[model samples]
Target: MTRILAAALSSALLLASASAETLKDTLPHISVTGEASEEALPDRAILHLDIVADRLTATEAVTENERKTRSLSDGLVRQGVPIDDIRVVGVTLQSVATEEAAPRGAHGKHVSRGFRARSELSVTVNSLDEAASLLSRAIDAGSNDLRGVEFVVSDERTRLERLRIAAVKDAEQRARNYVEAVGAKLGRIIEIDHQEAVSATEANGRTEPLASASGVAFLRLRPGVRRLTARVSATWALSR
Candidate 1:
C-alpha cells in the first residue's frame, strides 16, 4: 500500500508538469495592439434646422411655428430636397415672463399670461452641393434655429470591413516582430479583438449667406478626409 501511494503521487506530479509545459508552449502570454487607418470622403450630410415662434399665448406660438415649419418643408421640397429625408425632431411649449420678475428702474412690470412654442426639424441632405443652399433657403423660409451640420459616410460598413483586414494584418506583423525580437517562433493566434473609430472635421461658427443662393457657388466644404481607424489586439502563441 505504501508503494502504491508513492507511485500515484509521482504520476500525478509528472502529469502536472507535462500539462504546464504544454500550456506554456501553446498559450500566448504576449499581447500586441496594431492600428490601421483609411481616409474617406463623406457622402452624406445631416442638417438640423429649427423653426421657432414666440407669442403671447401657447396656442398662438404653436400655430405660428407650425405654419412656418410647413412653409420651410415645402420650400425645401421645392428646392429638390427629398421629402422622406425631413424629420420633425421636437415641438415644445414653455411659459415666459412678459414682465420682469424683478422690477426694472422705471417701467411698471407687466406679467406674461401665455407661453412660447418652438418646433424643431432635422433634415438629412444626401447631396453635399445642395446642403448649404438648402439650409439657406430653409432659413429664408422661416427656419430661424439652425443648429449645425454634420457630415458622414453613407457606406461605412464597406470602409470598416476594409479597415478590419488591414488592422489584422498590422497586428500579425507586430506580433511577428515581437516574437522575432524575443527569439521565439510565432504560433497560431489564440485571441483577437477589433474596434473601429470614426472622426470628422466640420465648420461650426455662423456662416454668412453666399452671394448666389441658386447658382453653384464655391462652397468650400473642405471635409477633411474622414479617417476610419481600426485597432486590433492579437495574442500569438510563442513556440520554442
Candidate 2:
C-alpha cells in the first residue's frame, strides 16, 4: 500500500508541471499599432464617357450607337489619344419606357418598343491639358452622356512599398517606447497584422461646362496630391 501511494503522488506532480508549462506558453502578449502617411502628386487621370442613342427598335438603336461611337473614337485619335488607352467597358440595349398598366375598368395598355443603346468607353489621358478639349469634341460628336472623372498615380506600387517599410519601423519604435516606460524589456516579435491602405482626393473644385463645338468643355485640370496611409499592428513579448 505504501509503494502504490508513492507512485500516485509522483504522477500527480508530473501532470501539474506539464499544465503549468502549457499555461505559460499560451499567455497573451502586448500588441501596438502604428500608422504613417505620405502625399504625392498624381501621375494619371481616367476619363469615363458614354455614347447613347434611342430608336423605335433595337436594331436602329444599335446602329445609331455604333455610328456615334466610331465618330467619338476618330475624334480621340485625331487628338493623339492612343488606341491602346481607349477601351469599350460597357454596352447595353434596354427599354427606355415601360408600359403602364391600365385601371381595373380599362384593358391592359400595349407596351411601346422604344429602346436605347449605350456604349461606354474608358479613356486614360496622360496629358491633363488635352482632357477638356477631348471631352468637348466627343460631346460635339454626339456623345450625350458624361460620367465623372477619377485621377490616380501610375507609380502607386512603388509609393506603397516605401510607406510600408516606414510604417513597420514606426511601429517598432512605438513598441520600444511603451516597453521602456513600463520599466520592462521587449522580447521577440510574436505576430504582425497589417491593414489595407487607403487613397483618396481630399479636395476638389467644381467643374463648369465649356462652350465649345467639339462638345469639349474647358476643364481646369488641377492635379491634387494623393494621400497614402499604412497601418501595422505588432505583438511583442514583454520581459521584466
Best by lDDT: 2
RMSD of each: 11.5, 12.3
lDDT of candidate model 1 versus the reference: 0.77
| Residues 1-240, model 1: lDDT tens digits | 999999999999788667655765767666788888877787677888888888887788899888888888888888888899998989888888766555566776877767777887889988776787677667767888778777878888888988888888988888888888989988866667789998754434224445666574433343556778888887767788
Whole-model lDDT for model 2 versus the true structure?
Answer: 0.78
Please provide TM-scores, in order, for all candidate models, with all chains considered together.
0.76, 0.75
Tell me the deviation in Å of residue 233 in model 2.
1.5
lDDT of 2 by residue, 1-240 (tens): 999999999999788667545544785456788888888776667788999999999999999999989888888888899999888999999987665789888877668769999999998988665776676667777778778676777777787777777888999899989888989877877666676465666554235555557553576566667788888887777788
C-alpha lDDT of residue 109 in model 1? 81
lDDT of each: 0.77, 0.78
- Model 1 residue pairs with clashes: none
